[model samples]
Target chain A: MAARKPIIGVMGPGRTEVHTEPVDKHVELALELGKQIAAHGWLLLTGGRNIGVMDAACRGAKSAGGTTIGILPGPDAMDISDAVDIPILTGLGSARDNINALSASVLVAVGMGPGTAAEVALALKARKPVVLLATNPEAEKFFSGLAPGLLHVAGDVEGAVTHVKGLLAAQQGGAAGGAEQQQQ
Target chain B: MAARKPIIGVMGPGRTEVHTEPVDKHVELALELGKQIAAHGWLLLTGGRNIGVMDAACRGAKSAGGTTIGILPGPDAMDISDAVDIPILTGLGSARDNINALSASVLVAVGMGPGTAAEVALALKARKPVVLLATNPEAEKFFSGLAPGLLHVAGDVEGAVTHVKGLLAAQQGGAAGGAEQQQQ
Candidate 1:
């Protein structure tokens, strides 16, 4: 079988949250994380808007010469960030968050807002590995009671990238086991 | 120009909410609303899942000999209701909710769960007219502060349909003005 390229989905605040100094810091964190993911030869997926953490991550991935896919909320390509290598216009609006969650083999949440929180919930529901980088109190509170193995809180880009790699390894291991079982 | 057929998006709870007596009432309401929408020559759109209010609405529309569209969350057609004439497999997951909201010229919200509430918010954000039938306190509270002209609270299927027709007329009037301006 051909080696599958991992797709990591990054979810965070959009332009509605405004670009304050604190918000800009979160965007920077997302950029570093995007760069690390691309360096590992993984594709990055985001909300595909030209604002907030999504744009930052897409820019970082592009700078690292990595392919990035933006799953857009509307059919119009105008809302897509220039850094995105591919734009998937779903026209699904906020519900598109589920696409962001399910499309990724693993998800990284940079900051929490209503939209981001919804994506995190969907990712958790799907039992996908979620790495949180500089999450807000609401996100911390939402995942507080969940089982620890599925959720990881990373304080830095390196830690987030490491967690993502470990999760990817575990996912590949499980897939291999399933394939073997089917063959048997 | 050909007269456009209005598409009405219906938002409600999913199967996870269970089909109990109370829940069934909501489904019945959705069914009646769907029938009324179809009878008015308008198309009905729902989440496309077979288990909850989505199924009921689709069934009602089909029974009324109306065309129905299901904006599915997942890529597979298996989850789509049999009564749906058209199944749009977005593979976008919950993000398909935005498609539902955006595709419809008007929206009918039967019950509000997190998913349904998100759709309502999206519809409102897009400036689409939304009709609430038997809305919960949360939904009622959410719309309480919005401009009265854009939101309608209907008690029955007839009332909902009436509100939809009125809104559609208002929309057409606005569109006609734009068309006239373009011609000039």
Candidate 2:
């Protein structure tokens, strides 16, 4: 049952609003991903705040009556967004590290900066499937040359979300196939 | 010249979506505030990202052709949304201190959680005008006991924006009056 609902962790800043571009597109894509995840009965984990893409994704999940989890750092000094259904305040030493380690079964990093790079590296070390959306080209150029296929790049939000969904489905199917063979 | 267009620091979380009790009310308020701020020719500073109220506010500011500044953290994260014209990455340091100690005319906090609380305290400590929207009950209780006119509370977005505009006007008038008295 737990395997059925794969957790999808989204990595980004928790308490800052960074809008270097039009946010509506990202907001739309995030909500769409949330809807798709809910439709597929998957869990959505994020840095929870009622602002930015985190809130947009949660709105999408809740609109579809899906369960969303927010890993918060503190209650008084820090917090998740208003859209979070479950707020887990872990007071972890490394804010991004804890969130990265707990985002989901497969991690998706969108619009990352310095803080999330270590999380991305951690995901790579863990051998977890990672999808990068609008990530730093320099970082990609550097990391891709270092280790090919460690990061999956997408052209846009649609491309990124679709690619991740496909990866998730394949993993689920492969796991089910193994279970069936064991039963036989 | 810098003082003429006083910087207004807007703080909130990134990547989270909002769903107010009545639905869309908070968003409407956030957008209205952005529009009002732009109309007043005030600079809008925020965490640049495409999500939640941040995006909405950016949209409003850009539509009005107002200058928007994104105070980003980290060296490689692309958290800036599309509407941002100027992007400043402040490395990995906590921006709370910088934002609170900002040379801004006023500080407006939208619907946010604990992260918003930290900024609110920072603004208060800096003796800046802080207007809080969608604040928690405990915060309201705390503010009520602070002083007679330290904080101004608004029920909705229009009220909040109007209240801030009024504050800005009064601040300008007081400064001008003081300048005249000094000359005499």
Fraction of native Cα contacts kept in each candidate? 0.20, 0.00
Off by over 4 Å in 1: A1-5, A13-26, A35-43, A47-50, A61-100, A109-173, A176-184, B1-5, B13-25, B35-41, B47-50, B61-99, B109-170, B176-184
Model 1: per-residue Cα lDDT over A55-99, one tens digit each: 889888988989999999898988888889899998766767878
- For each candidate, what TM-score against the reference? 0.60, 0.45
The lDDT per prediction is 0.79, 0.63
Could you tell me which residue pairs clash in candidate 1?
Answer: A92-B98, A92-B99, A95-B94, A95-B95, A96-B95
Which window of ten consecutive residues has the lowest lDDT sum in model 2 chain B?
Answer: B92-101
Candidate 2 lDDT, A60-113, residue by residue in tens? 888898999876645543546666788877654343343544357777766553
TM-score of chain A of each: 0.90, 0.76
- Give candidate 2's fnat, 2 decimals: 0.00
Give me the overall lDDT of model 1. Answer: 0.79
